[model samples]
Target: MLTSAIWLPATLAAGLFQAARTAIQQRLRATLSVNGAGLVRYLYGLPVALALWFGYAAATSAHLPPLSPTFFGFALLGGLLQIGGTNLLIMAFGERSFVVGTAYAKTEAVQGAVFALWLLGEVLTPLVWLGIAISVVGVMTLSLGGKGLKLRDVFGALWQPAARYGLGAGLLFALTSIAVKRATQTLGDGDVVLRALTSLVAVVTLQLVMQGSYVILRERGQWRAVLGSWRTSMWVGLLAAAGSAFWFTAFASAPVALVRTVGQVEVIFTLLLGHFYLREPLKRAEALGLALVVIGVIASVVGSG
Candidate 1:
């Protein structure tokens, strides 16, 4: 029988890989447009995703899982939302510092809990809910930064570009998480790895087709930019594919809410990456917020475990 224990490690790996992918994609913004950078993820990752699916199938001697209408519907919706969510995140990078923008996006855990409970019927324990609350407070603290804890500044911060884009991105990401979980469920009983790879291949292919068409029609000039940056784009593709594989596998193994809440470790990873690599300084409030996030993550894991 599959155990939720599998999701803990899978989600942690996904968080680390995703943090690296976001950092690389942020750098790509220098040479490529938002759409261009986003395109590189799906366009380049398609082949890698296909290879992963085939490699798993061949190694296990597993045949292709039969696809159902429910799977296609959920996968397509999830793919589209994921593309939108990614672009929104890229836009947030332009509006705020890398770590701060990512902090705003991390609000997905709170929103994801609501969506998962409502749409996926995955209920959370009281302890898990407390962990989610603690993590969300930490995220808000990060958004506030070193500003005075005044009501006006707090309210005004939400209207800022970073908050706007990041919250929107979080919402789309939450929806995508629900849809992807639903898609995996539709595959019925199977090897969890094969089910995840199959869903990843289908979702990535749909993203490429949809996003590629848009890039071709409206942003034709960006094609040269995307290809020109193949050196860096390739890294983005590799990390994104690796991260997504783990994410899908986690979804198959555990509740979406639990997976996402634990995935909050991405915020901590982003903080270190921004400080050491990008030379972004950490402030007092931000440090406190990071501490809370860490504590919350530990609580969440224990609660779920």
Candidate 2:
């Protein structure tokens, strides 16, 4: 049987790739509108995902798994929720500092466990829950910043655009994780890699059709922007596909809650990206928060073991 050891590395890799992809997508926002930059992820990623799935199938002579209504239902719902979550995160970028925006969404790990339990009937042990609580405190420490820790400030921040969008994004993303996990389980007795790839292909295709159609009909100008920026968009797509492939594979191998808990390391990657690439200065509070996150992740891993 596959264990947390099997899935841990994939989750860490996904976090790294996802952090980089998000940084790229955030940069694209300067050149393109929110939805346009968002479209690059699915529109460009479709081909890469398709190629990987087909190539693996050809190499292994793996036949397509039988699809069921439950599979389509989960895939469709998860795909749509992810698109919404992505846009909300992008929109958060516009409202506040990139690091803070991303940190707010990292709150998804805590909420994800609840959604996983409700939707998939997955439960966690006491130690794992302690790890999750520690991680949540770290994230909250970062999100509530020095100035934000005051009583009045905390209430005020919740109503602000960045906080509102970030929290909403977190909730939607939590739901998306649960849905995708359910979708993968529908492919009973299939190869882990094949199951992950098949689900990714289907989800990405659905996103392209739905998101692409919206861009064309409602945001025609953004459609042109998407075409004009193919060079950078391609990088965004490549990273998005790589990150998602790792994520799906990890989900197939382990419980979604544990995967997401470990996935919180994306906060560390985001901090590094912000400091080095964007030249954003790290505040003392942020530095402390980062240290807490590392501790939380370590505790979570040990607990899983």
Candidate 3:
């Protein structure tokens, strides 16, 4: 459980950082919708993250992962999934509240645990399974907090052709976690460094594609709102960088299960942040979802322990 011990603080830090990421995204949206500012946010965020990693590497003497074409290929694939998932999530934000969108996204935990087991040969005990189950219930509670969910609605969402967008985003996010685990393992001792670099490359490349397309096809002013809010952009970039650094470190240090299980704390923190920062109402169902998420994730970790 030493990993768990390290993971506890990492979890706390990651949650706070994730909360900050939420704040950044809101600021981004307010300043610049999912338009130009969004693209700028993605592009600007990478360097800030890089600077932090440089500082960290300086302090820790972490060397860059020795890159071959192989390293680049693995990292490139990982970055594609990571950036694609994030793009989906950003798009979803316009359609749903951050709480709803993120809760759905956090279903990545169950997906991640499964992938870690299958791809990385990471094993979970029965207790961990219980925890995962508990967390899934919590996620569902939060996701369906608004409506009176019938079993049919859930099934409908699953089979609903229209709901495919949201489900696709979630599935892509799950795959991102899998790719990340693979890159980290492949990078060996420089897992953290590689993860940071990979994310930086992935995000920047995606932004280039998006922004270039927007520049070519859309109105010139489409990006006006994006860069207009400089203050928010700066803050969003800062928070995004900090959160990425902390999360990448956690991923490098702990087993993906424990890291992700603890990572579910983001929902709890996000709920609180939403209530206070966004003045959102806390519904009973959502509260239950939050509790279940925390308990389920904890149960899985503790049971495994």
Candidate 4:
């Protein structure tokens, strides 16, 4: 019911938040590459996400699901993997524009559907496969449309650091999806509070670990950067957090695979924002790619139904 209840609202929220995030990513891409800067931004975003989840939990009087060491461990591991994936994506953004970076992110839909079938024993009908195929085509169209690269050139670009990173992120994102579902099961609460709380703790814990480690290493002596980054990036982080929370909250009610597959709407949001706000050019090839992805998502929804 979360999806139906807040589906349009959540999607709209994700769109607005991602728009801002894309703008920040493009600005950072101008000077900083995605790897380091992207990671920093993700870490910064976690706290904002935490605050939102906490606020939601308090307002709803949502019950906390019971926790065990095993559950906590899974949450931590999944959070780490997701953060790592986001880092890879940031690196990808450095290589290309937000559109390409987002197209790469859509790979998670296919990855997640497969993982759900394998790990959660979730059923996928022929229609689901069709949807996946269509979505893949759309994603490919999006990625290749903007650049004038031929088919071979596009494949060759896969070897680039950013593409590799994006793929890596997608894989990790699939893993994160698994972890979240597992976390949801552990809580045994149909409400979104427990899941939100678990994610809040997990992300915050990881954020601290990553930041603390950096502080200890004095790697770049970027305390000034951290402080400055927080001021500019906190809200972006909050929006991403809200997006994550709503997504999983929706997951609490919907089929995990369906939720994730449909959630690929983030790519559409990212690409549109990339073009409108970041002024990233949309080429014929990319337009065709986007069309393919949209068609695929439609098929997926129908297939899943």
Candidate 5:
């Protein structure tokens, strides 16, 4: 994967699938407890993750790298961080309006750049950094939901609880991305797809153990509720697993920060699906924000190559 440009499409597909996964998760939420719904993301995903790994290996006759302690160290750290980041995001959404909290969480790209630079020495070109900035601005603009709030007003609200949770989530997620990249790289240069699949399986399995156990112990009742909603829950897991597979592939091949910068297009996907698909009028601010996000994604892609 590193020898080619598959990372770009992989990242884009990751975003698209993530949007779809979130949609399914939302439907799951109607009948399941928050924990139950969240559990479905990893619980059902484990099977899919396992299937993808075995399927890829079988088809490609891929060589499995020796699993080192270092790989497990990074993968475990990434799994835990991802779990924390997700909970923080839910808190952020609860603390403020969904749009506002989501905008703040969308700062992951910028935060990812910082963490990747600090942890992995992944220095980005200036133009790529600029592109990340523009994409973030667009995300914030769309978060306004055409409420006519000034952009500065968002900054003014940073002292609130929502900002803390949002920023914290972004920070953790950035670190998660860094850890994932490091985990994949620990295998050295080899089959990119195989390496990515291996890491994905490791991370998802860790998630299943940690998060699944929690749900079983603390919210045993949620298991029945989730099972009752299996029709929707399984789709959520499938989408999440697919999204994660693409993300792992991208991270295994490219700079984590650049991949994340491109993944910011997920917000654009949400906008298109939520509004245009529903026949809602696109607000002027949202339109401008869309334009900025498009330009930013382009700049990041071009600057990286």
Candidate 6:
């Protein structure tokens, strides 16, 4: 029972670990290319993912489930979309302001709801919709903070490169969530955590093969730097693996939209970490934004329950 009832808890833990991983990955950015740094997680995290999968398989006395065509399809689609979405975010960050780019990227929650509805035919309760809306607004407010961005600035910049890149990333990420969720379901009624771990192993392996090849061909030089700073990079991998495991767990246990809507708590974790760990100042809007996020998460949980 310790791990049996771990849906929302997994989501919360995923946010924390993801926040930590992002912080570490930020440090890696100083020395490695974006692709290289991104590669480190999947490259190094593969072993961890495999270990977790096998461990759970043994723990549950579960035989390796037969992999289905639908599973592979969604797994591959989710992996590829995750990579593409991440790359689009890089483009958005490069081509436009972080505030505006993040504001758009944060729309993944709402987009996820739509994707879940369209792709997975998941219908949500009204309270969950309220949660999604409130959380999204809070996220945008937090993102646009200190930039003097108005509602008009956020919506009016349709022609900007960031708009396309950020929104595209958001949609792709939304799809990735749906695809991953579907992938797990194809495994039948095995343990949810085991199903999730199995899917994580598959997706991470696919991503590693795809991205690892690119890194080897294009960013050959980054390997040396990546290894040189392995002390930090290793932690990045571990945190990434853990974060991904928790997220996959949550995805398997719940609706993707609800999972993502609740997952917006990641922003709160980010802000709090910045304030306490990094000694950063919390702006007024940010404080207000965090409050709204909390409210939204509560609403989402209550609706789901």
For candidate 2, the lDDT comes to 0.86
Whole-model lDDT, model 1: 0.87
Ranking by TM-score: 1, 2, 5, 6, 4, 3
lDDT of 6 by residue, 1-305 (tens): 01345888998899889877766675566688878778878878888899898888888798877799899999999999988887776566566444445556768999999878887788899999999999887887776654434867666665578778878988988888888988988998878888899999999999999988888899889878877887888888889889889998988888888888888888877776656765657677676777788898899889987
lDDT of each: 0.87, 0.86, 0.64, 0.66, 0.82, 0.80
TM-score: which is higher, 1 or 3? 1
User: Which candidate's TM-score is highest?
Assistant: 1
TM-score of each: 0.96, 0.95, 0.83, 0.85, 0.92, 0.90
Maximum-lDDT candidate: 1
The all-Cα superposition gives candidate 4 an RMSD in Å to the true structure of 3.1
- Misplaced by over 4 Å in model 5 are 1-3, 93-101, 147-151, 159-163, 276-282
Query: Which is the better candidate, 2 or 4, if ranked by TM-score?
Result: 2
Clashes (backbone N, CA, C under 3 Å), per candidate, total 0, 0, 3, 10, 0, 0
Tell me model 6's lDDT, rounded to 2 decimals: 0.80
Q: For residues 1-305, write the lDDT of model 4, one tens digit per residue.
A: 13245443453454456556656655654444334454555566666666765776788887666778767776777777776787777777777667777677668878887888898887778887787877765775676655544778679867877678778888988888788768667776656545755665675566557654655465454544555666555655565665666665655555556666666666777777777877877676666666765676677667655
- Cα error, residue 143 of model 1, in Å, equals 2.8
Better of 5 and 6 by lDDT: 5
Candidate 5's TM-score? 0.92
The superposed Cα distance between candidate 6 and the true structure at residue 7, in angstroms, equals 1.6
Lowest summed lDDT across 10 adjacent residues in model 5 is found at 272-281
